[model samples]
Target: MKKTSLAGACLLALSLMMGSGAALAKTPPDQLIIGMNMNNLLTLDPAAMTGNEVVGIVVNLYDSLVELDANQLTNVKPALAKSWDISPDGKVLTFHLRDNVRFHSGNPLTAEDVVWSMRRILHLNLAQASVWKSYGFSKKNIDQQVSAPDAYTVQITLPKANDPQLVIYSLAALGNLGVLDSKTVQRHERDKDWGNHWLTTNEAGSGPFILETWQAKDVLRMKRNPDYWRGEAKMNRVVLRHFQESQTLRLMIEKGDLDIASNMAISDINALRKDPQLTVDAVQRGTMYYVAMSMKEAHFANPKVREAVRYLIDYQGINKALMPGYGVLHQRPIKAGMPSTLPDPGYTFDLARAKKLLAEAGYPDGFDTTLRVLSDQPYLNIAIAVQSTLMQAGINAKIITGTGNQVYGAMRERKFDILVGRGGSGMEPHPHSSLRALVYNPDNSDAAKLTNFQGWRTGFYDKQLNEMIDSALLERDAQKQIADYQAIQIRYDQLIPAMIPISQMVDSVVVRNEVQAYQPHPSATTFLRDVWKVDEGDKG
Candidate 1:
């Protein structure tokens, strides 16, 4: 036998490696691997979801009656509902379901599923129940609120007249409104669990993907739904590997082992922009990071003190220094891009003004206080900056940093003095979504503790503001409704509630060159249905 040359020997080794699946493992054409920090993911059940990380995953597994337009976050587009009609009184909404949609378990989508899914939200009293409860839905009345008029018709009746647009948005937007496969979910129900325990790790959705495996703090894998109503996904599988550090994600993407890095630090994203093989996208999400002062605390009970806290924030300074490419200075409960959002009103870093306000509020020397913040980047840094500035105004703030649950739990329980956190209501470009959550708190009773209502949680309530929110919901005229929202926002600004909107949150993601049509949702959700990968030679 002739002695094999070095090149021949190398070719033989390469063939053997390829045969062993090493080549396919490097960058599978049919699979998309994502690296992101998913430690915050508490549940996959849409009703209990409280974080964006889970929404990014749930949106692919489930379909809503209506969806935010991919190109425009504000515009509502058809999803499971093909068309809808509003009653003359504006208290009833009727949606005509799309035909032939099937769940992952081969159950046909129908109006009954829609009705059951919505009623389950109220019955379970999950995180999303507060939104519906505000609209007069309750465990006792949910059956009356939602009804299936026919196999393909879903009719929802509000307890009172409301803006039909907002009503539709509340049911169709992201969050808990994703219709579940009723029969399949109910079959797995044990002791009235409402499939909550089962759905935490499994999915019965009809969206573009099916949940294959979900090992918390380990990995989440989803396979393309071949029977998807819209059509099959381009990729065969999508994997979200748990990666807490941004550096590990950077290395994964650089090595061609990951298709997308969803949660990268600002510094890493900026550096990745220079790499030819990676694309860095910094998009504004429908979110705001701000400081909340609990009215339960006597030190923050005065409106003057709350107003002073607004002026004490170094918004522009913090955005430019600590939040570069991650935040934009934004002031107002409603996010900037949405309809009816008021102008900034120019709350700047005015130490003297804050000091004067503090004096007028009977804290002439300023009082020592505690500021709670999540022990995470941006939150902790923002809290530190605010702490430094407040100290100058004689307000000695002791920063208390903890996990999101620890800090936000205190706020929910009305126990924190000041909290630096992020929140957004309607990622659908609707003002009601934000206003209803950030301003309206009709019931403050411990028995009626609407913890999901951020305003109620912060102990901020004004009967006038509540009435305005209700009136805004009742107004049917688009222009008049917008004007009403504007008025409500003006009142909120004057009242100086516990919250002071600081900056709009921005998120960045790095994707490899092989990926295409990767549009980031303004809500910071990841829609992987239309995402496809191309071969190196297929690159344009």
Candidate 2:
């Protein structure tokens, strides 16, 4: 399974949702209004925000103890902690706190808060656990890994000191830990509604911005925090309005209403580039656009059938016609920058081979399969293209389109014969984070049958994957690590679960010159602390 990439720039515009049916307003002198696809804050509670919408808001509202650098990995820098140290044996991690850091409520941050917050996260083990579980940790459970020696120092006790995950915690930084004031969480938990408490809606982050209001599915507004440890935000306020329709957002940007339009539709992308008022930040995402086949069916169970389906897909044609230059065609499961034992052998367009495989698989005339797809133009085009290509090989595919949530739910439930979806390929540039969920259940938890999404209950593959991952954890030799990785990739190639050979990405941001410091990161937008509203002439 490819780790989903978040390489795309944020899309949508805020002004379109202001919906008073009025004309586009002039850019405010000091305010930056941005657009997003949707804004559903089920809970601001860190424990509950596993999905994108919540994470989007929480990433702004809360401060993770450590932040993975601008590239999503490679470096771990201080957020709450000024510095940290690892024991010689790699069993204990100690940190020194930044001086005078306080929660939004004016309570000084202490090490006690760190311990309590971690303890609570492990205790509940819901959404955050999902994120943490992908960190290649499987103890009997989550409780066994964490310990607090004192207020300022956290000691994590691993089952094995040799595990590679010890050194890789920074890679999971954005998702793993958010430093919460232990006092607030404890009080809220005592009220038995921590998930719905005021703290969840409000926040006490040590970051440069504080949450002012969140109009669910509509808008999220944040104001600069004056006492930020990093220094004050030059911008007075940041407004993120959720706009579902791309055309509406395009109009807003054209009217000079929004300072930043995150997701501009394909139809509007070219036209927006002509506008002198907006700047488009575009990059190929680390996301893969592929079809997920159902494992439950006999036809899907056979590798030949899966290969035949792959044959039916005109990867090149799809990229040129449907996706246009938006993304590359995905053939294997692992994308670049992610840790995979699989090698990039790539894919071939073999129409003859596809027909042979289909005939051999008892589909001499080609069989029909429903392709569940998102009701978007890109996916719809891919679905139609796939159907046409499969017919050339004597297979029939029908496209069933719906909303994103609907398609995702159907995929999770194994409800579709084949589903067209885009997955983030390289969340972290490291292989451990990408393969951990798909290969073995991490030592700290029980969800071991994670990666074999085909419901392959075979102990053989599971044992093999676990042994490969564990050996990689133990490997101190550089050459041996590479060898182990190669072995893992070979196994992954053999298994062919959600096979995606190449990664396709769509990463771009469109910002007005007034909103300054709009550099893009692999994970998400930079913190509001770095965002500033500039003069009209200095907008870029």
Candidate 3:
């Protein structure tokens, strides 16, 4: 147990040390400072970012070929490409770009630039490169690659006809695959350094804003692009101020210092809802919060022990305590009714049955286990509720908490008996991304290496999942796709890799009344490109 530097302390510490809303005075609206509760932001490079903090900023500073729109369901217009056509087989895609789209460096965006940007992804094996596999891609799936048929048309062809969504996913995977100028990459390569120099901190994106300055671990500043590909951003400039204090964030929100704030405490969320000055809204998130048992802990390998642990969790109580009416209890890792929630009966909860099962497994008196949680406030409530519930069922649970990276690293190393985390699907809610990242082991499969969080890899499940994704691609029949999904979901239930889904927590955004046209997607970062401030003089 080591004390965290002030820069790393999240909202929970701020809520205790400083009164809620105290940090607001430190930042004001003329300043437009935004608060980030999560601490893990490493690099602005599209290839290096993993967590939401850095990605959130990247989303605003760069424009992708497509973006999730207001409805949060579909990718719409205003991407680098004005329009796109999908081939009959849903494999080949042709994008028609807008003319005169200029990068921040005053270079015109061309079809060749798109090719260079995407090809670079393949060449680099970037952190998010695995996401491209859905498009019939591996290390070498871009057979034909992106080609500039003309100045305004970029044609891309893949080897196989897979998901139509793949066309959009590839662009959305990174900072909108922010169009890279061909000359820029070539210059970097000539310099023997590649696009690493400029693409790292400074971007040549065609988005509404351009990166003005990035002070590592401190702040990121951007100015509205005058010659933006789409149109000008409403704000003159945006300053993303990084503060670890949750109180600082809430204060900023209350004092009109910050126009938008996220990752607020449950209590703060409830209180904010009562204020007319701000909007407290929630959407059904694609994220599923659950706990996974580490195989490294021998006792966790026992089915009875795992089931007992699952039963002892009071998910409903924890969710209610965290943010009343803000979440929906998840029956499976996926949300029910989502085309991908994947129905399974193993997600149900029963305390008595769990105790009985534990007894049958030779733990009638219950068992002692260690549970790890994140510094996020909601997780704290979950930890406490789970501890009390498990104790009643004859189990002793010790709770461990730390920063997100610390917890994630420990989980990857299999250092804890049980670890809690939230898994989110893409904007489309496709199961392939979550399934591969959490269940299928990349080491054993033909797929690229991904994060199999719970170590749930098994030959049977792995084979079945691949077959299901592949079957969906081969068959045009709706019924066949349904059947494949059912079979996969049933097998996943039998495996029970991670048990006890708490709920789906949506990405809630709080915006000022003066700010209009803000759009947020469950999967997309909270920054809204369509949103603009309604000027007092322009009030209709």
Number of the predicted model whose lDDT against the real structure is largest:
1
Instruction: Give the lDDT of residue 110 in candidate 3.
Output: 81
State each model's CA lDDT, in order.
Answer: 0.84, 0.63, 0.64
Candidate 3: which stretches are off by over 4 Å?
1-33, 75-78, 133-144, 159-161, 173-176, 185-193, 323-326, 340-349, 442-462, 535-540
Candidate 3: tens digits of C-alpha lDDT, residues 351-435: 8888898888888887788888987766777777777787888788798899876887776555677767766454454555455
Q: Per-residue lDDT tens digits of candidate 2, residues 1-540?
A: 121121112222234345546565677767778877764447677765654445555666667667766644557777777777776666666677765787777788877777656666655665665544444344345455666666666656554445544344532344435667666655655455543366556665665678888777678888887887777777788888877667767877777778888766776776778877678876544456776676565678777888787667777777766674466655544455544435446566688989899788888788877888888767788778777877788767788889977887676555677777776425555555445433443331224434323222211134667777767766766677767777877776677554443336666667776667766666552555677676776534
User: Mind giving the per-residue lDDT tens digits that candidate 1 earns over 1-540?
Assistant: 232364355456655765786742467889988888887897999988877789889989999898776577657778899988988877888999898899999989999999999999999997768778767889999998889989999999997666677766665556578889999999889799899998888888899999999999779999999999899998899999987667667766876878999878887788788899989877887678888898888988998998889889988899889887778988889888766888888888998889899999999889898999988788899999999999898989999988877998888888888889988675656787787767778887766677878888888889989998878777767899889889988989888889888888888889898899888877645678989888878666
- Report residue 408 deviation for candidate 2 (angstroms): 3.0
Clashing pairs in 3: 11-246, 24-251, 24-252, 28-257, 29-257, 64-176
User: Positional deviation of 4 in candidate 1, in angstroms?
Assistant: 46
Q: What's the lDDT of the predicted structure labeled candidate 2?
A: 0.63
Residue 86 error, candidate 3, Å: 3.1
Stretches off by above 4 angstroms in model 2 are 1-24, 134-144, 159-172, 283-286, 324-326, 338-343, 437-463, 496-498, 538-540
lDDT-wise, the better of 1 and 2 is 1
Cα lDDT of candidate 3 equals 0.64
In candidate 2 the C-alpha lDDT for residue 380 amounts to 80
Best model number under TM-score: 1
Please report the TM-score between candidate 3 and the true structure.
0.84
